[model samples]
Target chain A: MACDARGKTTTIKILTGLLRPSEGQAYIWGVDVEKEPEHAMSRVGAVVETPELYPELTPLEILTYVGRLREMSPDAIRDRSKVVLDEVKMSEWADKRTGKFSKGMKQRVGIAQALLNQPDLLILDEPTGGLDPRGMAEVRDVIKGLGRSGITVFMSSHLLYEVQETCDSVALINKGKLLMYDDLARISLWRKGGRVEVEALPPIPPEIVERVQAAPGVKSVRGPDGNRIVVELEGGDEERAALLRQLLGWGLRVRSFKDVEMPLESLYLELVKESR
Target chain B: MATEGATQPTVPQAPQPTVPQADRRTARGARFLIVARFELMRQLRRRRLLILLIITAIFLVLLIVVIQVFRTASADSYSYASSFGGFVPTLAALAATFFGADALVGEFEHRTGYLLFPQPVTRTSIFLGKLVAGFSLTAVTLAVYYGVVATATAIVTRGLPIEIAYSFLLAVLYSTAALGVAFVLSSTLKGTTSASVMTFAVLFLMLAIVTAIFSVADLRPDGNLAFAGGTISNILSGPYPQAYPGDTEFPGGPGPGGRFRVYSPAVPLSILVMAIWAAVGFGLAWALYRRKEMKG
Candidate 1:
C-alpha cells in the first residue's frame, strides 16, 4: 500500500495485535484480535516501523528466540533459521552481533526474522524507509521475491516508485482513512487513454506528425523533439499496434514504440487532490 | 466504533494443524519458559550484569579483609556472619535495579516491543517470565553473597549458625520483593533510565526514609518494605530484637531524656510483610502491563 506518515503504522500495529483499537474489532483468519489475539496472530508476521533488535544478540540467536516463542520445535527452528537467513541474503552474517551491523544489514535480518515462520501474511511497514538507493533496491528485491513466492505481502510505503515496482495492488491512505484501493494496472492507465511513446529514426517532417495526429483512436500527440513523439491514444494494446503499423506505412523508419506508463506519483497526487 | 478482527490471510501450508484451546493453554506454559530462558540470556549478556558481578566480588573481598585484619578476637558465628547480612539489602537492590528496572519498560522505550509484543504469547506470560528471570538473577547474587559469608564464618568459628540460613531466606524474599517493585516501576515508566533510578530510589532510599519517620514518631514501621527487609539482619542479632518502640533509659548518656528509643518488627511479621509486598507488586505490574498499548 502507499500512504503518507499518518496512521499507516498505527493501522499495522493494530492488525498485528501490538495496539488495541479504541473501538471496533479486528479478526485474523476469523479469530478476533481482542478476544483471542494469540490465535489471531499465530500465522501473521510483521515488521512494524523500524524493528529494534537486541544489539547483544546475533541474527541466528534472535531468530531462534522468535521461533521458540512461535512454539516451533528445535529441529524446525534450526532448519527454518537457515532457510530464512539465506532468503534475506544474511547467511554469512548470521552469527555476527547485530550491534556491528549496518542499518541495511539489520533490516535484512529483520526481514529474515519475519520470514522465519513461513507466515501466510507478511506485513512490513516502511521496509525501505531509511535505506540508501542500493539498500532500498536490495530490500525491495527481497520483498518482491517474497510476493512472487505467493505470500500475501501487505507493505506500507510512501515511495511511489517503490510501490509501483513492488506491489500488485495499492491502497492510498490519507488521514487514517483509505482514499483509494485498486490494482496497479488500473491506476497506471490514464483516464482518457494509454500514452504511447514512439521514436523514429531522424528528424520527422511536420507532415508525418500531422499524419500521426489524424489517425483513428489518437487523442493527442506531443513531441518529436530528438526523434521521439509521445502520443495519447484512445485504446489499449490493439490500438497501439495499429498506430505502430500506420507509422511504418507512412515511410518514417520507426525505431521504438511502447506505452508510457503513468507514474504512481501522479496518481497519488490526483487522489490526494480529489480527497481534499 | 469498536474495531473488529484484523484477519490474517489463510494460505495452505505444510499441514501444521491448528491447536485446540486445551492445547493452547499448554503451549502458553512452554512459551513462558521460552521467554524466561531468553530473558535470562539477555540479562547475562549485558555489560551491567558483569559490572554488578565485579562490584559484588569486590564487596566480598573487602568483607574478608575486615573480618581477618581488624578483629583480633572472633565473635560467635551467627553474629559475625549476620553482620555481613546487613549489606544484603544493598546488594539485592543493585541486582534488582540493574536487571528488573528496565525489564518491561525497555521494550517500549527502545522500541523493541515492535518486535516482541506482536508474538503469539500473551502479555501475562511475558511479564511473569521476565519477573522470574529478574528474581532469579537477584536470588543468585544473594546466594553467592551468603555463601561467602557462610564459608568465612565456618573457617573462623568452626560452627555454622542456623540463623545464617534463615537470614539468607529473608534476604532472598526481600530481593524478590525489591524486583517486584522494580517491575512495577518498569511497566509504569516511559524511560528505562528513569525506571531504573526511580526503582533504586524508592526501594533503597524512599522506603527507608518513610520507615525512619514512622520510627521517630514511635509508630510501627512494620509495613514498610525497607523496615520489613530489616529482619535480614535483625534476626541475626539473636532472640529477634525488640518488637515494639520503647525508650531505653541511660543515666549518663547524652539524649533528650538520656534515653535511646528502639523499634524492631517481629521476624514473622517482617516475613509476612515482605511476601505481601512481593505478591502485590507482581499482581499490580502484570495488571498494568497487560492493558498497555503501543501508541508510538
Candidate 2:
C-alpha cells in the first residue's frame, strides 16, 4: 500500500510545464509540454505540494489576480472570484489578508485560486499534505466535489487508503518507475482467478493434493501441511464450488474454507527490488 | 470509486439549473497589464515601499531646511534644489532596488509561481507586467520626491523653471532604468534575499568598479548608468558640462586635457544612454525569466 507520491508530483509538474522531462515527451491535451506548453498548460489548474500565496494579498485579491492573468475581464474576474471563494468556503474572509490565516485556510485560498479560470484538468499534488485530520478531510471533500463537476482530477497521495478513498483510476509508481495502473477496485486483482486456502483436520496425503490439482479448473495446489492446502483455480465461483466438492469427497477432512488474496505486497516488493 | 460524486466543496447551494458558458477569449490572450495592475497593488501594499518614501521625503525636507537655516550669500540661488534633482535617480534607483530586486524571486521563493506560472499567460507577459509595475511604483516615489524639490526651489526663487519638468522626465527614465537593472538581478537569482541584496550591491558596489575602470583608463563615462543619471540632474543646474573640461563640478572631472577639453554626457546622449540601459536590462531579464524552469 506504499505510494511514490514524489514520482506522481514529478509527472504533474512535467505536464504543467513547470519541469521538463529529460528523456521523453510529456503532453497535456495532445500538446507537447516542452514545445507547446503555453497551449497545453493553459487548460490546466494545479496545486503542487503546499498552498503558497502572498501573505499580504487577501483571498479575493489573489483569485482576482489569477483571473486577470488568465485574461478574464474585470467583470468576469469579479464574478468568478466570488464564486471561487464561496466554493472554498472563504467568502466571509475573502477580504482579509491571508497572512493571518492557518494552513487549512491558506490551502482553501490556494484551491480557490486554482479554480478561478475553471481549468479543464485539475492536478492536486498531495492537496492534504501536512494537514490535521479535519483539514485533510476538508480538502478531500473539496477535491471530491471538483471531480463530480466532471473536471478531470489528478491527485497524488502516498497513503494507499487516501488514493483508494479519492481516485477513480489509480496509478502506483515507485522511484520514478510505474508499478501499476488500473481501476481502483482491481488493484488486488493483479492476476486472474481467485486463490482459496483450505485448512483440514489432518494433512491431506500428497496423492490427495495432486488429485485436487487435477480437478476441473484447479490450476495449481500447494501445501499439504499437516493441516491445510492452498488452491489456485482458473474458473469462477462455479468452478470453485466444484473443486471444494472434489476435495471433500476425497475425504481430506476439510475443517475450514476461505478465499485468500494474491500476494500483492510480495509482488510489489519483488517489482521494486528488481527494478532497483 | 471513492471519488465518484463524493466530497462536498463548502459552497452554498442554489437550485441546479442549466447554464451557458461565459466567453474566454480574453482569458486566453497574453497581456502584461493584467499582471501589472495587481503587481502595482502588491508593490504599494508592502511596508518597505512606504518606509522608503517617508525616508526620502525626510531627506528632501532636511535639504530645504539646511538652505533656509544657513542663508548663504546665494540663498536665492535654489542651487541646492537643482543639485538635489540630480540625486533623485539615486534615491529612485534605491527604491526600485528594494522592490524590484525581489520582484521575480518572490514568486519562486514564496512558492507563488506554483500558482502564477500555471495560468495561461505567457512568461514574457508576466516579466513585462512585473517590470511595468515595479517601474510604476518607482515613478510615484520619484514624483513625490520631485514635488518637494520644486516646492523648495519655488520658495527660494519665487518661481519654478521649465527645467523642472525636463528633469522630471529624465528622472522617470532613470527610475525605469533602475528597475530594469533590478529585474535583471531578480530573474537571475533563486531567492528573494539574494536577489535584492545583489541588486543593491550592483547598483552601488559594482557601479564603483565601473567608475574606477573608466577613471583609471581616463575614458569618457557616457556608458555608465550612474554617470548618465547625474546628467539628468546636471541639466537642471545649468548647461550640460562642456567638452574635455567636463563638469569640474563632477568629481574626478575637468577631463583628461584639463580645461583644454572635458567630456560630459550631452543632454540627448544622456537620454540615449539611459534608454540603452533600460533596453538591455529589460531584454536580458526577460530572457532569463523566460528560460528558467521551476525545478525548485
Candidate 3:
C-alpha cells in the first residue's frame, strides 16, 4: 500500500481497472479487473495519494462538476457534495479555493471526493497522511463507519500503528513481494508469543536460568534486573500454565506475573527481519 | 425432540430486497462527473491563465490605440486599416499557441495528473475535456479581441470591407490549428519549459526557416507564388510556422505588395489542415495520457 523512499511515504497506485497484475487478477465486487474493467471499476472510488483537486474551483464546484460527469442530476450532485463535505468536516471550507487549503484540509477534501458516490469499494492510499491527531481520529472514525456500512476499504499506510488501528485486514509487501496477508490481530498473534514479566520474590537466581529455560513451552529466559525475569512462551492457556508449574517446581517464588501485548511495530520489525 | 418436531418448523428466510443495477451505474457515473468537473474548474482558476487573458486584452487594446494614434497623426485610413486587419490572425495564433502549448505539460510538471487518472473516467475524456476547456478559453479571448478591433475600426473609419470579416474567421481557424499543434506538443513533451520552447521554435522555423531556405535557393525568378506555395506546404507539414494567415507575405518576387496576387491559404485547405493537426495531436496526447503512470 505504501512504502518509505528517502524518508517520504510513496503510495503505489492501485486503481481498480487500470493496473493488471503480472500473474494474477484483481477484482472489485466479483468483477474481474482485466476483463470487465469498466464494470469492475464502476463501484470503486479512489484517490491515489494527493488530492487531485482543481485549485481554481471551489470544493463545492469540484464536487458538482465530477457529479455531472457521472451523469447525476444537478440536485443529487449538490446534495451528495454537501453530505460528503460535511462527513469529512470540510463544509466550512467548501466555498474556498482548494489551492488555498492546508495539506490536511486537502487530504480531507480528497477523502470527501472519494466518498462522493458512496462507493462500495474505496481504495485510499495513506488517507490520513497529513492529518493532525484529531483529524486522523476523525478519518479513522469515518473509515470505521464505512466498514460498518458494508463498504470494503482497501488502504495502504506506512504507519503500522495507524494500520493496526484502522484496517480489518492487510497485505504487507516489501520490495514488490508479498510479505504477509491476514487479519491484523491474527498476524500479530502469529509473529511472536506474548511476553510475561515476573518479579521473583527471592529474586531470580542466575544459576536457575537453565531451569527456567528447560520449563515447558518456555522458548527463552532472560533478566534485565535482579528481581525481574522475562519469559517468552508459545501462546495458549495450557502452555502458560505448564511454564508456571515448571517455575513453581523449581522452587522459585513468583511475586507477580503479567502478560505484555505485543506492539504491531515490534511485530512488523520481526517479520521484516525474518523475511530477510 | 417430539415436542420440538410438533412445533411449527421454523426456517430462516433470506432478505428479499433488490437493488437494481441501474441504480449502481448511476452512482458510479455521478462519481466520475465529480472528478471531471473538478478538473475543469481547477484549470479555469489558475492565476497564470487569468494573467494570460489580461495580457491578451491589453495587447488588443494597445493595437487599437496604435491604429488610432497613427490615423490621428498622419490622417491615413489605408495604413491604419492595413496594419490592424493584417495582424489580427497572426496575433491571435501567437496568443493561442503560447497558452495552449503548455496546457497538458503543466499538469505533468505540477504532478496533478496523478490525482485525476485514478478515477473511473477514461483518459480520452480527461484529455478531450481539458482540450475543450483550453480551446473555449482561447476562442473567447479571440472573439473579444475581434469585437474590440472591429468596433475600434468602425469608429476610426466609416466601415471596413466584408473581406475583413472573412479574414477574422480564417484567423480564428488558424488560431485553433495552432492550439491543436501546441496541445500535441504538450502531450509529447514531459517538461513544461521544453514543450513551450519547442512548440514556439517549431512555429517560427516553419514560417521563417522554410521561407528563408526557398529565398536562398531562388526557387522562383518571375513570381514568388511558387515559393509561397512551397512555404505553405512546409508549414502544413512542420510543427510551427512564423507567419500564420494574414501575418506577412512569403518571401520571393510577388509579395503582399502585389495587388494582382492574393496570398491566403485556401479556405478548405485551412480547415482541413487544422482538423488534421487537431485530430493527430489530440490522438497522440490521449494515447500517452492513457499509458502515463501517475506516480508522483
Which one is best on DockQ? 1
Candidate 1, residue A217: how far the Cα is off, in Å:
15
Clashes of each: 20, 7, 15
Superposed model 3: Cα runs more than 4 Å off: A1-12, A16-25, A32-38, A192-202, A216-220, A230-245, A248-276, B1-44, B47-53, B68-82, B85-90, B97-99, B153-159, B191-201, B204-207, B214-271
True contacts kept of 2: 0.46
Misplaced by over 4 Å in model 1 are A188-263, B1-26, B72-74, B239-260
lDDT of 3 by residue, B1-296 (tens): 11111122222232222222223345543443444345445545555456656776787778777765655654433334445554444454555565677777776677555555555566556676666666666666667666765566567766644444544565566566667667778877878888877766665455445545554453322122122222223232212333334323343445444423224444455556656665766677678766655444
The positional error of residue B20 in candidate 1, measured at the CA in angstroms, is: 17
Candidates sorted by DockQ, descending order?
A: 1, 2, 3
Q: What TM-score would candidate 3 get against the native? A: 0.76
| Maximum-TM-score candidate | 1
Clashing residue pairs, backbone N/CA/C < 3 A, model 2: A203-A226, B243-B262, B244-B261, B244-B262, B245-B261, B245-B262, B246-B262
Better of 1 and 3 by TM-score: 1
TM-score of each: 0.83, 0.81, 0.76
lDDT of 2 by residue, A69-176 (tens): 565677777888889889888999988988878878878888887787777778888888888999888888888888899787878887655776777876556767
Best by lDDT: 1
Rank ordering of all candidates by TM-score, starting from the highest: 1, 2, 3
Q: Candidate 3's residue-wise lDDT over A1-276, tens digit each?
A: 335642122323544433435566545555555565455555567766666566777788767665555445676677889999999889999898777788778777777877776776778777787678888888889988888887778787888777877788766665555555666666644445557787788667777777777777788887847788788876555676777777778888877776655455545555556667
**Measured against the native two-chain assembly using Cα atoms, what DockQ does each of the candidate structures obtain, in the order listed?**
0.33, 0.30, 0.24
